[model samples]
Target: MLSGDLDISQAEGLKPMVYLVQPENFDQLGQSFVGKLLDSAEVDGRGHFEFEALKNVEGQVLLEVVVQKKGERYANRLENENPDSDNYMPLIWTRGETLVINAAIDQFQSSVTIENPSTVNASFLELRDLKKNAFLKYKNTLELLQGDEQLLEREKALHEYQAILMQFADATPELFPALMAIKWVSPEGNYERIPEFLVNQGVKWSERYPNDRWVKELAALASKEKLPILVGDQMSNLEFPMVDGSKTSLNAITDGKKLLVLDVWASWCAPCRLENRNVLLPLWQKYHDKGFQVIAYALESNRPAWENAIQKDGANRWLHASHLEGDQNPIMDSLRIHTIPANFILDGNGKVLAKNLHGEDLVQFVANYLGD
Candidate 1:
């Protein structure tokens, strides 16, 4: 007897059909059992049934057969024709079917009793393909390692890992377990390699899946690490427009001054805004005549907010200006301003003296710089 479930709904108007025959007595079995079974049945689209032969025979072979109207080739063509289509349904395959059976076998080996011998035999075949994929990834990684001297070779290795990750992303939920296992086996090298790997993968990910969570997460990780993640050279000798609409270059701000404090800040930045209230204002007032000058660069995206902050905080006493474009501000980009509430204290002749000074530290820093 042969029995199994079949889903023909996706076939639309196509009918379900099957032919079964015994290899030993093909003519006899076909004329009797196979012909009789086809004569009594009507099948279309989707349905399930069970069957059993009435006669009890010793040492007799039984063959079960099933066929769906749609197969892998049809599904592949549909996917190829419509890239964004989600019409393909998951089907049992050599690898996938093996993974399912193997998982069950593993569970059974771990203590559960296996009442089926068919599952054990099917699991053995499934594991071979799983191992084959694992070996392929390993072999590729080794090949990548062989040509490490060339930059293009390293890029190729990075691409291989990225391709694997993309496959995992596109896989169905049922296939995820095996895909994840493959991903786990793929080697992720040290921190030095991480930046390059992420950069290459990030570009592909952004292009393919714009709103993917992994891309954002990877970007955040790279950003937080202070990696050279942003593609650009460090800004030097930048000229910025002051709040009064007068232009002042960084060189001019530092020129003829005993010490120049290039305070990079914004109105929206609570920390920068609060610095005046905390200690900077009082210190600046006390030290202005003692050769201290502040050139505050506002990195505010809003012009109104920048002006409002400067006025409200009484920051007028300082040499203030802004490009009014936040991160895109030419001066900030030139300075490579990664973190806010940052500043560079420069000595006479426009050379950097100290960077990122704040609070009482700024007072102590100046006192030490001036030998006070």
Candidate 2:
């Protein structure tokens, strides 16, 4: 059972309600991709609430406690909403233990403190706070440095941060916190390989916490064969319905004829919007007739917003497709994409020629390949 007391005595106006949310792995737009409304209750005049949860035997589950006005609509924490206003805080749960939380409405996230068997959760919080403090301390110092000096300072800070996290993970005596902290800064991009230190730690953790969900997930991530698709790898096939109810497929459109740029993006992603305006558009104009095509596959939940972005960004020239399922879209899952503004450039033979080409590099890559 999970129980908590919300000290909303200082809160003004409407009576607040507390919601127990089984938060999704990632957020879609302003909402959880697949959040389950596990439980909800109106806080009494004294401000207390409780909910029974199934034992998380496999591993820790990330649950969210959302406190808001009785009928007020608001966005989830990942949507960049006012965190303090929503009184958002993430909670972790494990099997065979009862957890309690005490939070004041005014203080919310920062003032949150847990009770009984929250050792792992508490340690993770402390680690995160340490990182936050480092960022604050170095914010001004970073601005004063130039070029390589700035880069070196930032790298030094990152290394120090990782060392501190490792020390916490080593001494915490909890698999959940250790696994999370180790995986948090795992490598990605062209060098999509887990660090040796993390791999060794994962091996020890797996031995310690056998059949643990996160351990297995981290082990898979640490595995060499699980690397992300690179520039030379074959592109994953994706087929889905367009807004007009027309079907689109990467293989079908490319058809081993024109080179295809598989642009995986979303309307809500600011980086995606910037790349479309500054990179994709110019490349399209230069290479369209020379047998280059762009399949702008949008991962969006809102049909109107997706269409609006296309119109606003002048991206209607290419074939666009999406089921508007956002992060829940199967195509996204197949590609193992958790972030947006990702792309793959495919040759006429339906093999990946390059990936994540950007700015002048995007134009140059296409122009060089086509001999234009």
Candidate 3:
């Protein structure tokens, strides 16, 4: 048997109502059942009912509920709108409340806060547990780093950051906002290392949850970075055929060049073809003599189309080549080229300088690097 009480008081204007559920009853219901129960709640006229529900996976029940007024919009809007926002929904867990799940009645309030920004209070016991796990993982990794006498301090710090990120990845889905917070605080220079960790985590997550959209997105993001690294680091040793039917090594092609831009594109890709007219042609014309060069690697299954597109685009001024086998191109496979119109910029000595820079950024990057 289970029961609970919800109370709402208004002296004058309308205010949000509080819903409370006993932890014992919540634990008995299971996540799916509890989710349905919460779904049945009355929708107030204020656009949505924002509440927090606690669940125990093993117990299969909800423990408690905390209600608050939904923020004006969803918390995740920052990802698409601002690209940078520290505001994450807070999840608080008390003695009886072991898990905090936030839900909004309307789609606009989809995002939930992981930690209360207004109070800066870490009252949530679940947050403490996550932090504890992260600290333990960091300590273990730090010990390993200490044992390696030959490893530089810089390498140790990189490994330690990776360890902490792994802890965040292992956290529950509800704790994602907190994970994002940690990611935000991470140094930008570690993006390369971090993506590798994320890819591993994505693989693990995909295995655990077979058909999750978010998991797929995470995996794609990780895989995206791997493409450049594979080409710049591992495949640099191999020689490939140029459009003129002559063989050339990537190292030889880029020798002594201050910057080399690899444009992995296809004649069939509309965006790739479109950029030739609007973006690439102009930029190349302006920067070719300024120590910047483009190497367009076309992936066209049809040899004629590849040749035709090259001629039509007037790409003669730059280095253009194609394997004439679409996805079957060994270079494409080596680089894990999943999307068309991809690009990478490498500085002198074959070091990757920037990736996926498009439109204004691409032009600006060349200007900045060439001191224009």
Candidate topping lDDT: 2
Q: How far is candidate 2 from the true structure (C-alpha RMSD, Å)?
A: 12.1
Worst 10 residues of 2 by lDDT: 185-194
Stretches of model 1 off by over 4 angstroms after superposition: 1-235
User: Who wins the TM-score comparison?
Assistant: 3
lDDT of 3 by residue, 1-372 (tens): 111222222212212443443312211211111322231134354433443333322333322333323552211112211111111222333434323233332211122333332122233334434434444555556566553222333244545545644565555454333334334324232344334455556667677765765555555655654534633443364466788898877787677677888888887776677667667888778877777777888887787788888889877678887777776787776665565566778876667777666666777888899877
lDDT (Cα, tens digit) per residue for candidate 2, span 100-198: 888886556555678754666787567545544544454545567566323434444555545665666666676655654563332121123224455
Q: How far out, in Å, is residue 257 in model 2?
A: 3.4
Q: Cα RMSD to native, each candidate?
A: 20.2, 12.1, 14.1
Residue-pair clashes, model 3: 14
Cα misplacement distance, residue 95 of candidate 3 (Å): 4.5
Measured with C-alpha atoms, the lDDT of residue 9 in candidate 2 is 69
Clashing pairs in 1: 8-45, 235-334, 242-321, 243-321
Candidate 2 lDDT for residue 61: 69
lDDT of each: 0.47, 0.64, 0.51
